[model samples]
Target: MTRTVLAIDIGGTKIAAGLVDEAGTVLAEAVVPTPTGDAEQTWQAVADCARQVLGDTSVEAIGACCAGPVDIGAGTVSPINITCWREFPLRARLRELATGATVELAGDGVCMALGEHWLGAGQGSEFMLGMVVSTGVGGGLVLGGRPYPGRTGNAGHIGHVIVEDDGWPCTCGGRGCVETVASGPNMVRWARTQGWQAPDHADAAHLAAAANHGDKIALATFQRGGRAVGMAIAATAVVCDLELAVIGGGVSKAGDLLFDPVREALADHARLSYVDQLRIAPAALAKNAGMIGAAAMALRADI
Candidate 1:
C-alpha cells in the first residue's frame, strides 16, 4: 500500500483535490471554480480537479467531504448552496472513477473536525468541536478522540442552533438560526439592513475591512455574530463536554474582530463549570483543513 489517498473537498464556491500522505502532507493539489451550470458541469469540474492532482498516480483509497447534509450510507450529498446536486450520487461516481480503490465520504463539517483532531489546533484534545465560519456555518464533533458523525453523517451541526427567536430566515428553513446571525452572508445581510455604508455586492471580507477601520455598525455586526456563535458553542459544550473549539474558514480570517466577541460571549453564557473550561482557537491549517480531514478518513477507514 502506498499510504497515500486522493482527498477531495467539495464546496459551493470551489472544488479542491489533493494527494495526501498518511502524515497529512499534501504532495500535490488542484482547485477549480465550482460551475454555475448544471450538475454535470459541476461533476466535470470535480473530476477534472481530482485528475489534475492525480495525473497518473493511483491510490488505494479516496476520501471525500462535501458541504452537508449528506447521507453517507447512500453516498449522496445535498449541499444547500449547490442546488444542482440534491442527493447527488457522489460516492458511486467516485467509485466509477477508481476501479479498485475504496472511497470514504463525510460532510465537510465532519471532515473539518476530524482534520483538526488529527493534526491541527485540536491536537491533544479528545473531545473538541471544529467549526467552520464562512459563507455558511457548520460544525462537527470529535468525541473520544474520533469523529462522531451521527446517523445521517451530519452530527454536531451547530449552525441550526437557534440564536434569535425570529431574527432572520435560514436556508435550513428555520428562522433565527445561529447561522442567520453568524454566517458570512447573513452577517452581511444583517449589516445591510442596519444601513451599513458598504460597497455594492459587499461580502464578509468587506465588512471585516470596515470593522477593522473602526466602523461601528460593522463592529457591532461582528459582535452579534460572535455572540451567536459563542452562545451556540457554550450550548454544545454543555451538552457534549467539549474541551475546545477550533474555528476556521473564510470569515474567521477577520482575526480578533470576530474572535474577541466570541470569547466574550462564551464567557457571558458559560453557566456551567465544564462549559467554562472550553477554549476557542483559530484553525492552524488554513484552507487545507477539509482536504486534510478527508485524507484522515482514508487513513483510518475503520473509524
Candidate 2:
C-alpha cells in the first residue's frame, strides 16, 4: 500500500495542513488565517485546519514545519513572529491531534530545503539552501541529499546571520542581521526612508510595482535588499559548499527586480570559484513547498 503523511505548516500569518503521499503529491489541503490573539487560539486554528483537511483519511505519520527556533528533542517551538508561542509544545499538540500516527517537527526553512531537494528547484543538487524572504527571513539546508536541522533544529537561519555590523535591531536581539536589510517590511521601510511616496497600505508588492514602473527609489530598495540576500547566500555557499540556493516567500515573487541584483551581488562578492558556481533559482513548488517538505520529513525519518 502507498504511504501517506499528514503535513502541517505554521506561520505567523497563516496555518496550512495537507495530506501528502510518498510521491510528494498533495492529496488534500486546507488553510486558515493565523489568529493573533493567543497561543491557544492559534493552536485551535491549526488543529481545526488539520481536522478539516484530514476528515476520515488515515495517515502513517504526521510532519509539521513551523518558524523557529525549534527544540527537536523537546518537541517544542518558539517562533519569533508569533508572540504567544514562546516555547510552545508544538509536536505534542500535533501528536494529540493526529492520535495514532507519529508526529515530527522541524524549522520551516529545513522543510523548504528538503521539499525542494525532493521535488522542486534543488532536485538534482547534493547540497542546497532554501530561503524564505517574507515578513521575516528564514533558511534551511540540505546536505548529502538530506535535510540538516543541526543540533537545535535551527541550523539554516541565514536571516539572523549578521550582515551589517551596525544595522537595524532584530527581534531576535541582534543587530544588522540580513533580516534587517532584506525582509519585505524592512525593504519597504528603506524605500520610504529614501523619499519614495507609497500608498497607505504599501508593501513589498507595491514597492515591486513601483520599481517595475521605473521609480528610482523603489528600484534602489530592491537592489539593496537583493545585495544583502546575495551576501548571505555567498557566505552560506562558502561555509556549506552549497550547490544551489532556492528562494521563496512573498518577496521572491518580485521576479527580476529581486533576482537580477541578487545574482549581480553574488558575482561581485563570491570570489572563490567553488562559491561562484552556486546557482540560485526561484522555488518551483511555490506555496506548497513547506507542506511537501513536512511530508518528506514524516516519510523519511532518516532526514
Candidate 3:
C-alpha cells in the first residue's frame, strides 16, 4: 500500500493543500486565496483546505511548505511580507490539524529545493539551491545531503541578501535586498520608473515579451533584475560552492528574459574558478514542486 502525506503550501497570495503519495504524486489538490491581514483567518483557511482534501483519503503524515523566515527546528515562522504572522507557531497549528499523524514544517523554498533534489532538475546533484522568484524571492538548499536550516531556520533566504548597499528598501527592513529589485512586482515597479506605464504585473510580463520582441525599456528591466540575481548568486556561490542552482515560481515564467542576463551577470562577477562553472537552471517541477518537496522532507527523515 502506498503511503500518503497531506501537504500544504502557504504563500502571500494563496494557500495550496494536497494529498501526496510516497511516490510524489499529488493525489488531490486545492487552492484558496489567503486571508487578508489576519493570521488566524489565514490558518483557518489552510485548515479548511486541508480538511477538504483529506475527506476521501487517509494520510500517514502531514507536511507544510510556507513562506519564511521560519525556525524549522522550532516549527515557527514570521513571514515579513505577511504582517499578521509575526512569529506565528505554524508547527503547533499544523499538529492540531493533523489529528494524530506526524506533521512537519519547512520553509517553502527549502521544500522547493527538496522537491527538485528528489525528482526534478537537482536529482543528481547533492549540493544545490532551490529558488522561487515570485511576488518575492526566496530559496532553500541541501548542503552535505541535509537541509541546512541556518541559525534561525532562515537559511536560503536569498531574497534579503543585499545586492545594492544603497538601493530600495526591502520589507525585511533592509535596503537593496535582492527581492527589492528582482521580484515580479519589483520588476514591474522598476519598469514603471523607466517610463513603461504598465498598470500591473501582467503588464510587466508584456514588457518582458516586448523586450524579447525588442523593446528597450522592458529589456533593461530584465537586465536589472538579472544583474541583481547574478550578484546575489555569485555571492552565494562563493559561500556555498554548490553544484547547481534551480529557480522556479511564477516569475520564472519570464525565462530567457530573466535568466540570460543573470548568466551574463554571474559570468561577469564570478571570479573564482569553481564559481564560474556553477550551473543555474530553471526549476523543472513548476506548480507541484512544493508538494513533492514537502513529502521528500518527510521521506528523507527515514533515510
Candidate 4:
C-alpha cells in the first residue's frame, strides 16, 4: 500500500495544506488566508485548510511547517510574524486534527531546506543552506543529507544572523541582521531613500524592473542587499562548511538581477579557499518547497 501524508504550511499571510504521496506527488491541496485577529481563528484557518485538502483521503502521517521559532521537542511555535500565537501548542493541535496519523512539525526554513535537499536545487549536495528572501529573510540547513533542527529547532535561522555591527536595527532587536538589509521591504525602502522613483505600488518586482531598465539607485539597492546576503552566506559557509546555498522567495524571482550581485559579493567576501568554493543557486521547487518538505519530514521513519 502506498503511504500518504498531509502537509501543512502556515505563514503570516496564508495557510496551505496538501495531501502528498510517498513519491512526493501532491494528490490534493487547498489554501486559505491566514486569520490575523485571534490565535484560535488563525489555528482554525489552518485546520480548515487541512480538512479541505484531506477530504475523504486517508493518510498515514501528517507533517507541518510553520514560521519560527518553533520548539520541536515541546511541539510549540512562536512565530514572530504571527502575533496571535505565542508559544502555541501547534504539535498537540495538529495531532488532534490528524487523529490516528503520525504528526511531525518543523520550522518553515528547515522544511524548505529539506524539500530542496530531497528533490530541488540542493539534491546533489551533502550540506546546503536554503534561504527565503521576501518580506522577511529566513533560512534552513541540510547536513549529511538530512534536516538539522539543532537543539531548539532553530539552528538554521540565518535571517537573524548579524552581518553589520552598527547598521539598521532589526525587528528582532538586533543590529544589522540579514533580514534588516536583505528583505524585500528593506531593499525597497533603501532604494526609495536613495531617490529611486518606483512606477506605482512600489515593491521588489517594481524595483527589479527599474534595475533592469538601468536605474542606478535600483541597481545599487540590489547590490547592497546582495552584498549583505553574500556576507551572511560566507559566514555560514565558514561555520557549517556548506557545499551549496539555495535561495528562494519573492525577491529571488528577480533572477540574474539579484543573483549576479550576490555572486560578485560572495567572491569579494569569501577569501578562504573552502568558503570561496561554495555554490549558490535558485530554489527549484519555488513556492511548493515548504509543503513538499513537510511531506518529506512526515515520511521519515524516525519521525
- Candidate 1, 165-191: lDDT as tens digits: 978888988998899899898899889
lDDT of 3 by residue, 1-303 (tens): 777888999888888998887788888989998888588988899899989898967666888888887887777888876779987999889887666778778888888888988889898887888888888999988888677667776788899889989999989888999999999888888888888865554545676777878878888998999889888888887899887889887778889988998899888988798777889999999988877888876655652
Per-residue lDDT tens digits of candidate 2, residues 1-303? 889889999998889999898889999999999899899999999999999988988776999999988999999999998999999999889887767889889999999888988999998898999999999999999999889999999999999988899999999999999999999999988888899998868999999999999999999999999999999999999999988999999999998899998999899888798787889999998899889999998897666
The stretch of ten residues in a row with the least summed lDDT in candidate 2 is: 95-104
Top-TM-score candidate index? 2
For TM-score, candidate 1 versus 2, the one ahead is 2
The TM-score of predicted model 1 comes to: 0.97
lDDT of 4 at 111: 95
TM-score versus the correct structure, for each prediction: 0.97, 0.98, 0.96, 0.97
Q: Global lDDT of each model?
A: 0.91, 0.92, 0.84, 0.90
RMSD values for the candidates in order, in angstroms, are 1.2, 1.0, 1.5, 1.3
Per-residue lDDT over 226-291 for candidate 4, one digit per residue giving the tens place of the 0 to 100 score: 888888888888899888999999999998888988898788878788777899999999888999
Q: By lDDT, highest first, what's the ranking? A: 2, 1, 4, 3
RMSD of 1: 1.2
Order of quality (TM-score): 2, 1, 4, 3
- Cα deviation at 209, candidate 3, in Å, is 2.1
Over 4 Å off, model 4? none
Question: How close to the true structure is residue 258 of candidate 3, measured as C-alpha lDDT?
Answer: 88
lDDT of 1 at 172: 89
